[model samples]
Target chain A: MKIEVIVFGMIADIIGKQKIEVNNCSDTTSLQIKLTHDYPKLCQQKFVMAVYKKVITGNTNLNNGDVVAILPPFAGG
Target chain B: MLTSKEISRYERHIQLPEIGIKGQELIKKASVLVIGAGGLGCSALQYLTAMGVGVIGIVDFDKISETNLQRQVLYNANEIGKYKVEVAVQKLSRQNPAIKFITYCTQLTNKNAIEIIKNYDIIVDGTDNFATRYIINDACWIANKPLVFGAIHKFEGQLTVFNYKKDNNTIPLNYRDMFPTSPAVAEVPNCSDLGVIGVLPGIIGTLQATEVLKIITGIGTVLAGKLLFMNSLDMEFYTFEITPDVNRKNISIEEYLSYDYGQFCISESQNQINEISCKELKELLLNNRNTLQLIDIRDQEELPKVPVLEELLIPLVEVIERVSEFDSSKKIILICKSGIRSKLAIQMLQKKFGLRNLFSLEGGITEWLKN
Candidate 1:
């Protein structure tokens, strides 16, 4: 399955891309592993995953063409 | 008892059914303290003053710099080098002479946070650092004050209200509920380093002011248990539910007093790496130590690169991938512009490969260059 991932804040700097297309990501866990493997820098960052405007955790299945947002907490005033 | 001048000034606000004369009176009776007079505080303070918030307190120890003119609209070129709260209070007082402005030109420390916050009805956190944010959140929690939180980075911003009291039986989620701990220093750089769009904070801070007004007048639902995420680049806004952590213990004032906020937020464990002063590093370099591996974790574009210090250039983002290339037997010394990223790099490497021979150059290359 193909999924569109949108990265925000510092994560985009680490990934070097604001939007990315990934293939063969079936669940949130697998997608997380694949992202960390592809971009090793993301493993050290703390962010939450949201699918279709809802935050999800732990093995949430993803459909083809789903949009996933990776949002890291912003500390600036 | 509204004077004809006050009535005309707040005609738009008084015209609303939700915020009639009673709500305006409530606003006039409320007291709010804004912790920082930077980007977020600039907008929040402006709207709060214009909305007739009675007693507004501005707390900031920083001065206006050249770079602050971009987003901090409160200060102008003429006010450069002047204290932030002093200038902010001056400008806000002129804009709304009916409102009272209190200024705290000193930093909010653990000893003073609780006492200072207890005097206000609401606390607004406009600080850019995690240590101060945590301190303000903990202080608000202890004082039982509702906290209006706002943060911005790059093109994105977040806003939420914490510790807001709704009923006698329920407790709202605080900052710790959403983020149990601060992100690694390398993960979240300050606006000075990463850069933020000038208008992003204005939007978020306005929303923060709106939330504060809603809470003060009891007119609408506040963002007490929800986190609002916004991206100025795409103009996307999303609010997600934040559940309070049941396992999280209530922080006592004693614990907050003794907490090492700076060390805890920057580096979770100080024992992860040895810290060597710049003078000591100079001696080691002068001694012709071949076993010392100096790693520069700063971005390639960082200025004043040390030509004399023989080191490997591994930017912070690529440190983990290139960690294996370093010899485990050599004494590794990580250096960045301000020593923050270097410490984060040391913590990352230590957690992954258990590298014991790691040391972060204290004060980084900037200090080393001074020597």
Candidate 2:
């Protein structure tokens, strides 16, 4: 299943855009692996993944058209 | 028990049926402590003072720099060199003479975080660094205060209420549950160079004031377990549910005191050295003590000596002079009192001789005693 991944803050700088589509990602783990492989710099960044607007702690199955938001902690106020 | 003058002063708020006289009184009786007098603090303080929070505390050690003039609307050119908390309290007092203002000019440290936070009914996080953010979150968790967290980066901002008590069925989410660990400095450096839109903090900070008012009045649903995301470029707002990390256990005062958040964040980006936890080190020592060289970086006179390892003693100051003593071919471990100095030792070795076989004992001997 293909999912749309949206990134915010400095993660956008690493991913080079606000949104990117990943194909054939079955779970959150694979999605993260693919993201790390594609953008090696994301390996050191601390961020949370929101699958369909809900933050998931552990791996969860992803369906097609899911919007996964990569939210990094902003060090500014 | 609000004075007639207070009721008249808050007549606009009192007239609303939802707020009424009781909610207005609640606003007059509430006390809030806002950390950091930067963009977010300036905006939040303006409304919190005008709206008549009973007593407010301002914590900031920064001076008003020329660059702050754009977003921090509270100060003028003449006040540029003045302390932020001093100027903030002065201006806020003038805005609302009824509300009390307490100022803490020193930076918040672990030693004073709990004592200072316990006096206030609510805490506002407007800090700009990851170390202070983690400290504030842990301090609030220990003090049992609800934290109104707000952060901005470039054109985006995040706002939420952490550790707020909700229904019995739901567990509230704290900052740690959202971002378990602080990001390395490489991932996020000083934001002054990154640049945030001048108005971003004003908008997000005002929203934080709204949450505080709602929480005090007990009128609207609070953002307890929800994270609010805002993107100024797209002008869109999205809400995400935050799940508590089942593995994230409660932090004890002892554990909180020993953890060096500054070093923790820096250590990750500092050469990315391999760390040996106390538990892991203990298991490895049982078998690999002869194979691994353990070096103590503390002074020889330092107490709590572990004679079992038969470790070599080399003070941090003398590590460079005795560089030849370490056998890089075998795995080497550095031990210190708090584990912080050991990291410095590893960094020193990597920089001088480019040693790759160095590991720092996590939490040092203090953690070993606990485990």
Model 1 error, position B361 (Å): 11
For candidate 2, the lDDT comes to 0.86
How displaced is residue B220 in candidate 2, in Å? 1.1
True interface contacts reproduced by each model, as a fraction? Answer: 0.66, 0.89
10 residues in a row with least lDDT, candidate 1 chain B = B263-272
Model 1 CAPRI rating = medium
Candidate 1 residue runs with Cα over 4 Å from true position = A57-59, A63-66, B167-171, B263-297, B301-371
Interface RMSD after interface superposition, each candidate = 1.9, 3.7
B297-366 per-residue lDDT for model 1 (tens digits): 8777777777876568988877877878777778888888767667767777777778888888887776
lDDT of 2 at B83: 99
Error of 1 at B8 (Å): 2.2
